[model samples]
Target: MTTRIDDTALLIARALIAALFVAGAVQKAVDPGAAQGLLAGLGLPQVLVWPALVFNALAALALLIGVAVRPVAFALAGYCAATSFFHLIPSDPWQMSIFVKNWAIAGGCLALAVAGAGRYVVTRQRKL
Candidate 1:
């Protein structure tokens, strides 16, 4: 049985996660040069920025629509974990906060993957 609270929590989680990635995509779209520079600084090839931007946008859209929620959540969780180690993690305490937050976000995604999309999602998982 699905509780009201569970449905609400899942919706909120999906929305928040989608919004974060969408915002990131918008930032990358608005300042491609800066995005490329940042990626290059992290030792990533600048050419990868365009594809990453598209991936973020598409993944955000998928999350928002709640289609293929589990797989998307797992992929985003991995992406977040990777970005935390490469882009966010730093020696300074202030910078470490962002790193910690990325891991927290990844943890949330992992939870979402395990929980599925609840009753509110568009896509329904089949029971075996």
Candidate 2:
């Protein structure tokens, strides 16, 4: 049911979405002290930051390369929504904006989940 432009649009969307995850991973990697402290303050284990770093890096690459995009997008959607809580403090305009953006990203991921990666993926998707 999709046209070529739809597939191309999906490809571009995937890249843009993946870029966000890449930036997140890089930020944590480059500044673990801050990331670790933030997680610790949230009553999460500081050690959890490293695994998160790995997940973000791998997931970003997988999404960017269009590998298992449906599953990855679903997972990322959940991840985005869950992490959004960290920025849910409405008193801070900056945090509120991030929380809203995370929800928007989650919505986009859900769309990708429904649409799949289309034809331009590392593993070509069959028209269904």
Candidate 3:
């Protein structure tokens, strides 16, 4: 049925999104100093580094496991929005390109939040 196919597509999309989050989180976790520097470059306060690292890791884990996916998606979307706001503004064309990339990712996260992870998510089965 069409619904089943859509579910499969959503599952794949969710997995991909999870992978992105996990990779980013892992990178930050493995190199806190580097992550902090990156955040600082984005104009974020130093106090934000640890929280961002922890939240990113936690959010990625939750997404990977499909647990509380709606909220996770919402949070991720918010995170992306905040990043876009801070880092995506007042940049040259080259930097603007990277900012646009974050916009696209933020759009995807917003879609996930709105769609509630589709039928393939554990949250749908009340597993989380």
Query: Which number leads on lDDT?
Result: 2
Cα lDDT tens digits for candidate 3, 9-116: 767777888787777777767776765766688767666767876787788777766678788888888787777654554547765775777778788888877776
User: Cα lDDT for residue 87, model 1?
Assistant: 48
List all candidate RMSDs to the true structure: 3.7, 3.4, 3.6
Please write out the lDDT profile of model 2 over residues 35-75, one tens digit for every residue.
Answer: 78768778988998888899889988998888999999999
Q: Give me candidate 1's TM-score against the actual structure.
A: 0.85
TM-score of every candidate relative to the true structure:
0.85, 0.91, 0.77
lDDT of 1 by residue, 18-66 (tens): 9999988998889888778767888889988788889899988888888
Ranking by lDDT: 2, 1, 3
Task: Specify the poorest-scoring 10-residue window by lDDT in model 2.
Answer: 117-126
By TM-score, rank the candidates, best first: 2, 1, 3
Model 2 earns a TM-score of 0.91
Scored against the true structure, residue 20 in model 2 reaches a CA lDDT of 92
- lDDT, candidate 1, equals 0.85
The 10-residue segment with the lowest total lDDT in model 1: 86-95
- Model 2 misses residue 41 by how many Å? 1.9
What lDDT score goes with residue 6 in model 3?
80
